[model samples]
Structures are given as C-alpha cells and as structure tokens.
Target: MQKAYKRLMAATIVSFSFGLNHQVSAQSDTYQVVSTSYQKPITTFETYIGNKKIETVRYAFGNAQYINDGVMYGSETDRVVDLKNSKQTVKRLAPAPGQIRKYKDAYYVMSLEDMDHSSLTKYTLDFKKVGKTKKFTGYGRHLILIDNKAYVLADHMKGYNYSIKLHTFDTKSFATLHHETITSMLFAYHMRQVGSQLKIYGIRPEHEEKLTVLSYDVKKQRNVKTMTTNQYVKGGVEKTQTLTKETELIFNQDRMYEINHKTKQVRVLYDSKDDLVDYAYDAKTKTYHVLEEITKTAEFRVKTLNSHFKPIAEYRLKKSDSVSPFRVL
Candidate 1:
C-alpha cells in the first residue's frame, strides 16, 4: 500500500509539474520575467519584451519553488536569492520545503520530513527561525493566507483510504483555528482564493475522468459547495486560470475552457491541434498569451490574442538544445 501511494504521488507530481510549472517572477507593464527549466542543473530567468530577451539571470539551484517581490525561494537547497540585488542567502531551515507563504512581516514555510510527517515553520524577514507548528500527519500541498488566517491543504493516505485535511491558523498568534479531515477519493492539486471563498481543484483517485471543485467558506470555516464536471478533454483538466470573478479558464493539453462557478456552465475557449505548454493573461494590454508547440516543425511559439480570443500577434522562439519550458508571467 505504501508503494502504491508512492506511485500515485509520483504520477501526481509529474502531472502537476507539467500542468503548473513553478515559474515565479517579478513582472511589470514594460517587461515580463520568463523562467526556463532545462535538462541541466541550472535555472534561468529571462526578462523579455515580447520576443526580445533583455536580461538573463541564472541560478545554480534548479528547483525554485516560489518567487515573490524579487526573492526566489529554492525548495531542496533552501536557497533564497534577491534577483534585484544579485545576492544569495542560504538557510538550512526546512528539511524539504513544500510551500512558502509570506504574510505580513514574517514568512511561513511548510516542511515535509516524510510522507506522514509535515510541519509549519515561521521565519523572520531575514530568515531567522521564530517558531514552528506541531508535526502534521500528512503531506502539505499548499499554504494560503486569507485575511488574518493561514490555511493549509494536506493529503494523507492509509491502506486504500485517502483523506484531505484542512488546517487553519491565526496569523497573529499562530494558534490553531480549525482542523478538519475530509475522507474522499479526490486528490487535490491546486487551491486559489476567489472572492471570500477558497476554490480547491482536484480529480478522482480512481480515474482522471472527473474534475472536482470544492468551494470553502473561510468565515464559516466549512465547505460551502462542491461541483464535479467531466466535461474536460480526454486527458482531463491540466491547469486552471481565473478569467473573471465568476468564471475561470481550465486547460487540458489541447483545449481551454471557461467555466462559471455559480452556474457550472463551461464554454470552450481554444481547441488546438498542437500542444499548449503554458498561458497567461496581460491585464495592461488586455490580451491573452499562450505558448504552443508545433509538433511538425518541432518549434515553440507564443500566440497573443485579443480580449475576445482573436489572434493578434505571434512570436516564434528559437529552439535550444535543452528541454526548455517557458512560462509568461
């Protein structure tokens, strides 16, 4: 059963990484940061203006988990870099950093010691260890801050049974507010804040045919609604992007959809023959950018579309020897 769980987690990690590559960057209206992951051990963040590369910054560590402001947080190495200052800070704080969330003046990070042991550690702005929560009995997937509360999403597996745990803590006191365990076959991948509700996206453990969305009310401290839809492509929902307050865009490898949270209405946005690698929305230009791979030509291109999803411009990227995956910030 442990081996089976490991296999399931391995598959989930692969799919999750492909769907939501951790490309954290500092962006502006004039320029965007593009993180490129290759087969090598190095990671590069390139600042680009459309197709023109303006600045390139490389890191020795590869697994950059999170980036905020100008600081890049590395997971395994526990390395943090200030991209603006070109300085690196190494802190052996978390054994295996899962998620890092900055709330107010402190940083809260999730440490995964093993499959059954995870904990939350608090650090000062300068990476000084201040406090830590007790060990949790699951793998911490995400940590989010809402208002004055910090919410943790974790998953636990025992034998053939699976459970999802929601743990809430007060940011000011670090006191436990609520702890709830939900027994289900759903394997959650992502969680986002929509209005006052938390939208959790996951799929059934048995198969990837069905997509589940659970809306949790933070004020009530309970799940308010659950919606499941199998209206995705053959491979299932790969990624999601919030388009509006009421609607979100979900993507498969070759298809994109805009689904309403209230009505559960799904509308197809883009259906392509080629593989769609990544996508982003530019609020300044009011345009959509999608990274697509042309299999026949073995090339990658960025397609820009208007607000109505009409084609505006396209930029072809030069192919490299490494397996470079580009994300538009």
Candidate 2:
C-alpha cells in the first residue's frame, strides 16, 4: 500500500510539471515582440474576444473592423490579420489586395493588378484556404454579392469601343452562372437589393444626360443580355420612372415618381425641387427618408414618407455653422 501511494504522487508531480512547462512556452511565444530598425512604425490596437485579449498584431497601417460575430478582419501588406486565440494570426492573402468582404460563411479577398487579369481568393473564418477564382479580364474595383451570387463588373475591349462585362457566380460552389456584355452603360457604381430583385445603377455610355438603372432578375436565372434603345427597353429604367412596379418608388435629384413596369405609366409621388439635399430608403421600416436644405433661411428640414409615397411628418432643424444639419436615413 505504501509503495502504490508513492507511485501515484510521483505521477501527479510529472503531469503538473509538463503542464507548467507547456504554459510557460506558450506565454513566451505569445508575448514576444520583435523590434528592429528596419521595421515600420507599429501601432497597438486592442481587440477583445468576450472580454479577453485574443491576439495582438503590429502593422504599418490598417484599422480593424468587425466582420461578423466576434471576429475582426483587416489587411496589412500581403497578409490578413485575424485577431483571435490571444494571438494574431497573420495569413498571406495576396500581393495586392483590393477589397475584403464577408458573404455567407466565407470571406473573399480581391487581388488587384496592373494587367488585364485579376484574381479572387476565398477563405474560411479562421483564414483557412477554400479556393480561388481567377483569370477575370479587366475586372473593375466594384463587386456586388447578393444571396449566394457574386456579380463582377469588368471593362472588356470590344473592337474599337469598350464594353462593360457582367459576370455572375455562385458564391457557395464558386461556379459561373452568367456572363453578359452591356454596351449601353459605361460603368456601374451602385448595386442593391430592391424588392426581391437586384438593381444596378450607373452612368450611361454617353455620359451626358443622367444616370441609368438596370434591373436584373437573377432568381429566374434569366442572364440575357439587355441592349438599350432610345425609346424603351425591357431591362433598362431611366432616371425617371418610365415603368415600375406598384411598390417600386423612384427618386431622382428633386422629384419622386411611382412607375408601372408593364403599362409604362409614371405618376408623381413627391416633388421637393432643388431643396432636396439627400435621400435614403429603410428596408426594415419600408419608408423613404429625405433631407431638404432651406437655402433662403439657412435651415434644414427632414421628412419621412410611407410606402404609398405620402409624407407622414416633417421636422425643421436649428442652424449651426459647425455642423451641416442634413441627415439621410
């Protein structure tokens, strides 16, 4: 009995010593900061994972922003910083990173280049490699991801003229869905989800009169090429509402119109004239918010509209030179 008790005590001491040694080595690895004259200026930023410091990273530039959950993502040179596990995981992404966006359960980093071709790499939340989509010709700086699809707009050389190329892909499986060439519009600037549809607004090829909006129904899998004519086109919507859905409300510089897509009927919703400073739409509230600048009295006014394009209420704000009193929802 005495010999058995001594063996048990000796085994416990060995296990405790091994654990202590492992903890000391991990601490030394995590807390070590390398300093050198060749290194750039280091900035210390705090990242918290449930009230605990997961990791610290030294970078030349880039501010970390929350992507989703408690994970924070930022870019520095050719690497991506994942702040977690009480240590910073620096993963090599690309040489020239363009933009980083989170979609579904993965993160995509676009790589920009001087040549006509570019690449996009996909990674897991912990910076694990998923896959890459490459060989995109003249891929621009804009990317739009809706649902499980990613739309990439690129400028391709079409004989003597340049045409905008739209490429659609399934984000989950990374498969090509559609590729269409738009000859009417020069480039697209903004894209959004409008009433279960994807809409792209951009400047026209002429670049003269006004911006144009192209409505695409990706759900139907109709990736047809839409060519614009002077009168009316099936897929194009003018700056004004030539045709719209019953629930679709259109807003331009100072006027708002409700449009009928099939009948090509446009009805006036609201007209604020030149007083319209900015406008926004809230998907949750299903309302249109507008800000109007009263130039004569140097005052600002705000108003909200319901789904029927009727004004609910208006409020005037006090004037202050230090701050512009216009707010867009």
Candidate 3:
C-alpha cells in the first residue's frame, strides 16, 4: 500500500493469461487509473437544482423524476402544480409506462431498444399515427430534440460506433449526423460531460487495468479531445493506481449530466459514492463534491472541487450511507 502523485494500480477486476486475447492490451502508467479501494455497486443519485429544496428530486434507474419545466407525469393520477401561477393540474399516463422526464415544458421518455438490427421499439404516449421512427444501433437509447430536428444516437459498427443523430420528422431526410467513432490508441469508451472542459470519467470496458477518464465533451457534435486510459498489458492483467480524476467516480458508469446553456457546456455534477455529488446545486455554488469509496476497508472519502477543477478540500465520512440531501436553500 503506497501513495504517489501518480502510480500504477494493480487492476483488481480482471486477471487472466496475456497470451489469450490481445484486446485486453498492455498495462502501463500512460493511461489514468482509479484506486479500487472504493469499489461498490452504485445504484441511485439525487439532483438538487436552484436555491430551493422544493425544487429537488431523487433519481434512480426507472423512476420518473421532475424537472425545472414541470414535474414528471408518472401516474395516471399524478398531480402537477404550476409554481409561476400557483395553479395545479392532474395528469394521466397509460400503461404505467417508462421513466418520464419533463424539460422545457415537454414530457419525454427513454424508449430503450435491444439493437438486434431488424426492428425498433419506441416508447411514446401518442403512438397511434406515428410521425416517424429511426433505428439507432448503439448500446443504449439516446435521443434529444434541439431546434425542432429529432437527433437519435443510432446504428453503426458494433464496438466502434459513437452516436448517430437522425433528422427525424422529415420524410425525405435521413440520418443527418453520421456515426463519429472513437478512433485513437486509447480505444472506444462511453463518455459523458462531467464538467465544462474537464471531468469525463467512466468504467471503460476496453481498458483492462485502468479506468477511462476523458477531459472532453461527449455531447459535442464531435469529441473535443482524444485522451487515452492507463494501458493494461495485452490480455488479462491487474495493476493499481492513484485516485486521479479518472478514478474518482469509477463506480458511476451511468452518471447523469446536463448541458449548461449559459456557457454552452456540459457538466457531470453527480456520482454514486455520496449524496453530495448526487445532490442538487444552485447556479451560484460554483463548487462540486464527489465520493471515492474503499469498500475493501469499509472507509469512504469525500472530495470538494471548486468551479475551476481545484481540489479545495477532502472529508472523511463515517462508513455509512445515511448522508441526507444538503438543503442549502
């Protein structure tokens, strides 16, 4: 057990003979690695937005969470109160459907597909006379509407695929934005924006030893930068490393994110290790917190970061998950 500004961590997840498959690749210090002393099965996160606790919501895998525009219409008898006018409306949804999210006054749901490459299943409340449907061949479901054109992360090479933005709602128009693959010595990874220009970290399947942490924007029409993860010797091998930005929230493979329109940037402000990273924030906080767990020893670590990506402070948490949402309002 040692600590360094940078060190190689023996990867605890995979250990096998290197002579088997070259896909696992070499283990080295070039790629960034997170200390796995904090390994745990992460489940949920909560978001605090604005200066009010009444404006916050706890989010999990399948729960219909609220948004600034309006509360998610989860139940057929769900209630919504318009804060601007103090008016209320009772909403209904059929089939008790999937996760509903409201953004900018519209309700949308994530219609997940299996990517079998033949047909697609779309989750929609108004599906009678379908306007259009596009096929995306990525690992999960991704679709967003900006300026009226429907963008979908769709079909491409099995492992090399990135995102496909289809121009839905047009009869003659097809896939407007093609597949932008992750082509580099680093390998392919599932990355989302963790901060304006930094903090993109996730569990990398391609890298065997170290975790993948990209200091770029994945939502940008194109990848901002091409950063490589710590190299694992070709095949199944294990190494250990320091808690770099790449390893801070390695357990949160599916970290939630949002685009800050004011700065035209994306931010990954939540994680699974603690409620502080998962909690919401007002625009003025200018600071974010994250948790790195050492499940092997039953100890937890909390990190505080200013808006400029500086580690302002660190806190030692009791080995418990009882930290409540910080009601700073």
| Highest TM-score model number | 1
lDDT of 3 by residue, 23-100 (tens): 222111011111211123111222222211122222221222233333333222223222233233333333332233
The alpha-carbon RMSD values of the candidates against the true structure, listed in the order shown, are 14.6, 21.1, 16.7
Residue 17 deviation, candidate 1, in Å?
A: 42
Which 10 consecutive positions of candidate 2 have the poorest summed lDDT? Answer: 29-38
TM-score of each: 0.77, 0.47, 0.37
Candidate 3 scores a C-alpha RMSD against the true structure in Å of: 16.7
How well is each residue in 153-226 modelled by candidate 2, as lDDT tens digits? Answer: 66666457667777787776667788877666776554555555556655565645244556767677443333
* Positional deviation of residue 239's Cα in model 3 after best superposition, in angstroms: 27
lDDT of 1 at 268: 77
Candidate 2 TM-score over all chains jointly: 0.47
Q: What are the runs in model 1 whose C-alpha is more than 4 Å off?
A: 1-33, 36-41, 68-70, 84-92, 172-175, 183-185, 204-209, 233-239, 252-254, 293-299
CA error at residue 324 for candidate 1, angstroms = 2.3
Query: What is candidate 2's local distance difference test score?
Result: 0.55
Question: What overall lDDT goes with each candidate model?
Answer: 0.71, 0.55, 0.33
Instruction: State the displacement of the C-alpha of residue 270, model 1, in Å, after optimal TM-score superposition.
Output: 2.1
| Stretches of candidate 2 exceeding 4 Å from the true structure | 1-102, 107-135, 139-142, 146-148, 155-160, 170-178, 184-247, 275-287, 293-300, 306-312, 316-327
